[model samples]
Target: MMKALRAALLGMALAIGLPSGSQAQTLRVGMAAQDVGRLDPHFATSTIDRVAVGWMFNGLVRFPPGSIDPAAIEPDLAERWESGADGRTWTFFLRRGVQFHGGFGELTADDVVFSLRKSAAAATSAFSADFRAFESVEAVDPYTVRIVLRENVPSLLGILTNYSGGYIVSKRAVEQKGEGFARAPVGTGPFALQGVTPNQSAELVAHAGYFRGKPQIAGISYRFIPSDASRDLAFQNKELDLNYGRADQTWATRVRALPGVTVDVFEPAELAMLHLNITQAPFNDIRVRQAMAHAVNRAELSRWRGPDVSRPGQSLVPRGYLGFTAENGLPGHDVAKAKALLAEAGYPNGLTIKVIHTQLPEMLNMMQVVQQQLRRAGITLDLQVVEHATFHQQIRQDLSPLVYYSAARFPVADIYLSQFFHGRSIVKTPTAVTNFSHCNQADAQIDAARVSTDPAAQLKLWAEAQRTLVKEVCAVPLVETLLVFARRDTLDYGYKLVGSMGLGPQITEQSRLR
Candidate 1:
């Protein structure tokens, strides 16, 4: 069925006389996922969906290939943009002749308005919290978009980069496809999502009308091979050109030694942390929360993850992100101190906490290590492990008292602090994002930093925010794990691997499978 679907999609490409359709190479790639969660750019929160939607969409601006630095943002759908004197308004000039996939017609300001508006609406986007400052998005003309913010932000360009809530969708395509758009998305990117074969695989075809130029490869065969052993075997058997690698020292080292294989370990690293719900019982007491913090051994967790692909987490805000600070003054690992705190919190005989954990290999492994560590400190985790997708749903529904979440956001302190610690982002709320800790202690500092024009002042506020979050024992910072990927040496990504916001190696028009 997967092969037939691929063939049918390719047949349609050939029938339409797409450039190099008959001879262009199709790069076979395997991912560590059961299946894609959502392809709608507005709701593509999972790594698998991000990897797919990224190829099928473009934003007003984009982080340069192989970089996630804020300074490296370059024009994409919008050729040029300028900010108002007050820094509250931004005007973007859309590129002419740019076309959307699936004959959705030319890219215009109307689509930009619709996409941005949709991204800011809580009902439509998973990342709507990222756009809380947006007052309005208006189509000034056929090729001009004007965005007004309620207050000054750290970087307006940051919000326009090709990331969560940034990818633009065609107005006509979105309205026409409606909910079906997740399976069949339309955008102005180098590749088009041709078809999805359920749990099997997804087929992408090179967009002949791509503004950048026709893609070097014919397309990508994105396969969902969840098992490490199965995916590794398929890659070794030369059935897959590339595959997501286990992001541990052992796996990375072993894979790098394989014949004709190259392993890439790149940033920004995903920060794994234990969010203790302060609003819940047991954890409602600050002593109990501190006990959990002291129970965690960040160094041991980092060592287990392997120093080659991970580092001990220093702060709630991920390292390498702007405004991050290691001077958070968190409680270090001390089993004796942890036990004392638990006893003081009226859990003298230790406490059993129920947690809903994800069964995803990397996440599960990390959580298992934490469970053992907690057990040593007189805490037993009654882990109710579920499939990854179900875990996400249940966690958001506030079913988990202890949420061990690992994620990488747009390398910014504001985004990280606001989404993870803001009051408005508390889970089970009308405007919820990912405040698993249900912490609002640092709201003042976080809010102050967002509107601060002075860079030093913003950094100071962010530093204060981190310290407050830590002092309040909102979460126990664990380890920062880098992204690991193994690929055939014959494949050329056309650029150096460094950092990717898309959570995977991005295939561009220049990438080739030779």
Candidate 2:
């Protein structure tokens, strides 16, 4: 029956002369993204980049397949690991017989050391800070690795399990490919990179010698389709086996009603936030930042996409994060109080601040709502729109007084606080790439938590950091969006997908078309 349904859909698609699906065993995935920013595992910044890298790489530790649980930690390349009683030293036992792509011999302790050390390099890697606690990484033996930290390093496994810097790459391949490796990455995973056609698509073929097992599907073709409507059309015509769905509930509900279509909505998610640059004039005044924080109506913002599509954000940490709380530290909407604060800040005549955001539709809608709401509080939001990459570039250069960022990261509190609040991360400075707000209030608390051996104490420290940001009004949290995806009912993900950190769903050796 599933095969018949797929055949019918294919017939309709070809009738219209659209491109057809791939071979029966080759699953096609359509992403609503412009391009895969970078394929290098160490520098994959965007969701699409992570998606491609995940297919062909393995991390020392990983979140269990299809499990979105923030605390889910499992062995990936490292079969098992142990840490010293003091929690400063960790040793991992690498799984033997794992072969790198292109038959680059077997994975060993040297590849693990080279991959991790490179990821921690401040001069080159995009995620250098995550590995800041690492004092050293050494190959103890051919299949053994040891990591020693300068401090206790709370939740050390969590750091190694994160998607960004955790992927272990092939040392031999990197030495051979050099700069060209970005286009042709080699890893020891269930699949191997066949090739990529620039901004269009990436083709991956299954590895017969994959350590876990051979992939059920023969191959996968990832298509980069940026337009929502185009993705919908392609999915309907069976040109794509799956699609990254829209954020608004209307689209999700409509898609679910279609025969042989199933829609998945789950969390934890990326927090959509507005970052105010405190270094700037008006924002430098606490009263002005407080006024801006109070001016936001989270309920009103989530209404644009329906409550089902987005959760009204409460804190710096989202629901799935370890330190999440109901009272997230920001004041509720109070226009009268906001106006009073504006007056107190000597902006009674009203202040106009420029905010730059990406071209995504849901973002524009939310910003429009923000524009009207801030007007009621005597704050004019001068909105500027730019493409996604350009928006990230502009915000980092300190160009926009108010910057909008929506990201779903590892469920770690210190990671969030450090990236956005740590002074060392102030973009355009010597070291960091984020931290649009030049915030330094939580440095002490964040540092204290980093070395704490007690879990409860560490959590308390993280929560304290959130409280400081709330009081300082560094950034205003608005909404949390769940990852929503639609697929042909005939396709089987093989694993139970509760949530994911990769671009869409986890397509592993088990996923296949029914």
Candidate 3:
């Protein structure tokens, strides 16, 4: 059965960048899911898609390759960039030798301009909102691109990094291939897409023409197995070099005990937050919101959430991020105070709210703990579970009064505040976007910080907005969980795995089998 499955997996892509029947110097990987969303970086929402494209794309700037700190931005496609004295105009000096795959032609200012415009179009990009500050972007010369902003923005570099809206695509490739560009993507990264076989698997080969030079491994085969047990079995059988790991402590410990396995744990993982539809009735009342805020005991919650993998971060903004200044005043376990607030809000009998969430193990475990906590405060929670994709879809349509979500974004406070709390992004409104709470409380301060050229002033404004979000309970920040992964000890990842910006640990050109 295993042999038949292997044959089916590589049936078509066996000749990729290798003579037919060659071993391919292959590195096989097991993912936590069956497939990725859109392979287009601009619209890719799931981590599977993000990691897939990260191998084929190059952003103008990157987060200092291998470093987990979001603020550590460095040049990628551009050799260096300079800002005008007024701080409104920025010019990027492109690296001359970069080339797109499949002879799409040398990357130039034209491609950069095209990519920026593409990302800014609301019709094309999920990240169009990030480009709101752009006044103009033009190819000044063959290797020079200029960007003019309406105002000086502090998070400009953050937005231009791979984690944000910085990926640059081949204009020629996109124009010629049209919709097909996403399936067989073309970029200037260290690897090129060899083949894709839907939910089963995908193959990528090292790009010898890669400006960064040839990768250590000749090829990679990514196998999609939504079943965690199947993935674990494959890893034990040596069919995969790496496997996506469960966040549960028991699973992590079991993996760590394997003789030839290596386990990596990193911090500042996805923030688990509960968003209340503030546009709705009871939540519309600040007293009721406060009651809900005081209902959670983060310490007890962590035990249910796998203590070794979770920590109570006191701000909507996670720790290790800029403007992380509020750890003192966040609401905590106080059932008596919560009950008093509910009484004052004319709900002495307490209230019931329905929450819609993904059916993943972590989400289920966390919500169950939350259910018990809120019940103590006389708040009844009725949970509706759905598939991961449908949960995101339902919440965006405002179908639930409460929503629990886990997400990671560029560590900039302004971007978080703007996208998640700004009036312009309130869900169900005409401008409905990611603002699930339909909140406008932080709009003024968030906008003020966005345009501030002075870093200190910008940080202060961003900090103020976060404190406000916590106090108002628009979305109660819960815990920042740890990310874990297990890989064969024989494979050596050249760079230190301090942390990762994507769903899984990175497999770069430097990664190789010993």
Instruction: Compare the candidates by TM-score and give the number of the best one.
Output: 1
Residue-level lDDT of model 2, residues 1-514, one tens digit each, is 4355445444533443333444236677888666666688887776667777878888889888887564678888999999888888899999999999887989999999999998898665778888888999999999999999998765677777737788888899999999888889898877777777766778777776788876766667788887888889999998888888877878988999888999988666779888888998888898998998899999887776677778888897776677655654679999999999999888878899878877665566677878898999999988888766677667778898888777777777777777887987887787785788889898998999878878899888888888888889999998888788899987898888887777568778778777
Model 1 segments beyond 4 Å from truth?
A: 1-10, 16-23
10 residues in a row with least lDDT, candidate 3: 15-24
- Clash count (model 2, backbone only): 0
Task: Give candidate 2 misplaced runs (Cα > 4 Å).
Answer: 1-24
Give per-residue lDDT, candidate 2, residue 245. Answer: 83
Model 1, 250-351: lDDT tens digits are 999898899889999998899999999998998999999999999999999988989899999999999989999988898889999999999988989999
Lowest lDDT 10-residue stretch of candidate 1: 14-23
lDDT of 3 by residue, 1-514 (tens): 5355445434433433322333335678887665655677776766667777778788898875567675577888999999989888999999998989877889999999999998887666767778888999999899999999998776687778765357888998888888887777788887778777777887777676788766666666777887788899999898898887777778888889988999887744777788888879879998998998899887776665577777775788777677667653688789999999999999999998878877665567778888889999999988888766677678878898787877777777776777788888776565456788887887888899888777898878888888777777888887778777789987787888876665566667677776
lDDT (0 to 1) per candidate? 0.90, 0.80, 0.78
- Clash tally, candidates in order: 0, 0, 0
lDDT score, candidate 3, position 84: 83
Ranking by TM-score, best first?
1, 2, 3
Residue 240's lDDT within candidate 1 is 93
Clashing pairs in 1: none
